[model samples]
Target: MRLRVEFTTEPFDLDEAPAHALAAREVIETAELDAVDVGPFGNTAEGSTDGVLEAVDTLLRKSLEAGATRISLQVSVIGDGNGEGGR
Candidate 1:
């Protein structure tokens, strides 16, 4: 299975990127994923189910440890690798 994950860590800092945000970015960038897009408002990654799950786990822990008060995340099964529909 394949998954796509979108997430954000807060409290936001308009002046610069927060520690939590930087942590999240590092997790995604180094993870075994594809289609990575990171930005101030949100971030996204797509990969195999196991890869996405593992990355999410690390992201949550690191971001919170870096002082993120809240995290908003969404995950979706995008495909089954056979060109079939997802649930």
Candidate 2:
């Protein structure tokens, strides 16, 4: 299966990106994912089930350790890995 993940780390810093946000970006950028989009307000990535899951694990741990008081996340099965809808 293929998955897409969207996430945001809270305690926002208006002046600059917070440590937690930076950590999350690093996790997604280095993971085996595609269509990565990291921004001040949110971030998203897509990849295989295993890859996305692994990245999520790392992202949560690192972001929290970096001082995120809250995190908003969503995951969806985008495809079946064979070009079929994820029905």
Candidate 3:
């Protein structure tokens, strides 16, 4: 199964990347996911179910430790030819 995870850690800053964002990106990159992108609003990563979940878990914990006051997350299961998609 393919998983896509997107998250934002606040308080958001336009001039500099937040510590939580940096921490989350490190975890995602270390996991070697198929794709990872960091944007102004949040970050997104795609990988196998296990890989994505593990990365998400670690990212969440690390983000909090990095002083994130709040975090918003969205997770989805990519299309797999069986009508299970975007959930």
Candidate 4:
């Protein structure tokens, strides 16, 4: 099954979102993620459901650590589970 996962956290400035995205990209470095869509960050991103979820979760935590005033994020994903490894 595929999941269209989404969530809203605190609000963050657009300029700072890229930094968060860059950091979040590292999450894929040691995982089983098939790919990383090298675009979008901050309040948004697009990728496999699992990868997007993991990155959002990590970015939220990191944003808090970085003293981000408000880091709100939402994700809309689409996938076909029967088409495994197709993300």
Candidate 5:
């Protein structure tokens, strides 16, 4: 299964993202996934389902340890035509 995961860690200034966001981003980048997207509102990573799940778990724990007050997540299963998703 292929998956895309999106997440955001909060308690950060809009002008400058805090350490939690940075830590989550770092986890995603180092996950060796197929693709990744980092945005103002959140970050997303694409890869095998198991890999994405592992990375998401690591991201959440590390971000919280870095001081995230809240976290939001979305996950999607990629397919050829039909759309399927989760959050």
Candidate 6:
């Protein structure tokens, strides 16, 4: 069960914010039945559904931890192993 996640946060620059986000991603990638590989950096992460959900949770937590005022997230499930990779 794979899915995609797009997340955006309130604008505020913190020196360690991106690292916090990436750390969250790393945690999600290896947590449970999860594996995450980032796509191009336009606010998208695509992978297993469980992984995606976990990653989103991580993202929200990290964003809050980083002092984000707002967090917005979108999710889209990739093709159902339909041989196209949802490209």
Give all candidates' CA lDDT scores: 0.96, 0.95, 0.86, 0.48, 0.84, 0.59
> Model 2 compared with the native: what TM-score?
0.96
**Tens digit of per-residue lDDT, candidate 4, span 1-87:** 344333333443455554444444455344344433434432233455676566667766764664545645444445565665433
* Tens-digit lDDT string for candidate 2 (21-78): 9999999999999999999898999999999999999999999999999999999999
Comparing candidate 5 with candidate 6, which one achieves the higher TM-score? 5
Q: Which ranges in model 6 have alpha carbons more than 4 Å from their true place?
A: 14-41, 82-87
RMSD of 5: 3.4
Let me know the TM-score candidate 4 reaches against the reference structure.
0.46
Question: By TM-score, is 2 or 3 better?
Answer: 2
Candidate ranking (lDDT, best to worst):
1, 2, 3, 5, 6, 4
User: What is the Å distance of residue 59 in model 2 from its true position?
Assistant: 0.1
Candidate 1's displacement at residue 85, Å, is: 3.2
lDDT digits (tens) for residues 1-87 of candidate 6: 467766656553454446445544555555554334543233566676666676678677876786666766778766565555554
lDDT of 1 by residue, 1-87 (tens): 899999999999999999999999999999999999999899999999999999999999999999999999999999998877486
Off by over 4 Å in 2: none
Identify the runs in model 4 with alpha carbons over 4 angstroms from their true place.
1-43, 81-87
lDDT of 5 by residue, 1-87 (tens): 678888888986788879998899889988968779888787888888788999988998999999999999988888422354443
Q: C-alpha displacement of 53 in model 4, angstroms?
A: 0.9
How does candidate 3 score on lDDT?
0.86
Cα lDDT for residue 45, model 1?
Answer: 100
Judged by lDDT relative to the true structure, which candidate is superior, 1 or 6?
Answer: 1
Q: How well does each candidate superpose onto the true structure, as a TM-score? A: 0.96, 0.96, 0.86, 0.46, 0.84, 0.60
lDDT of 3 at 87: 58
* TM-score for candidate 6: 0.60
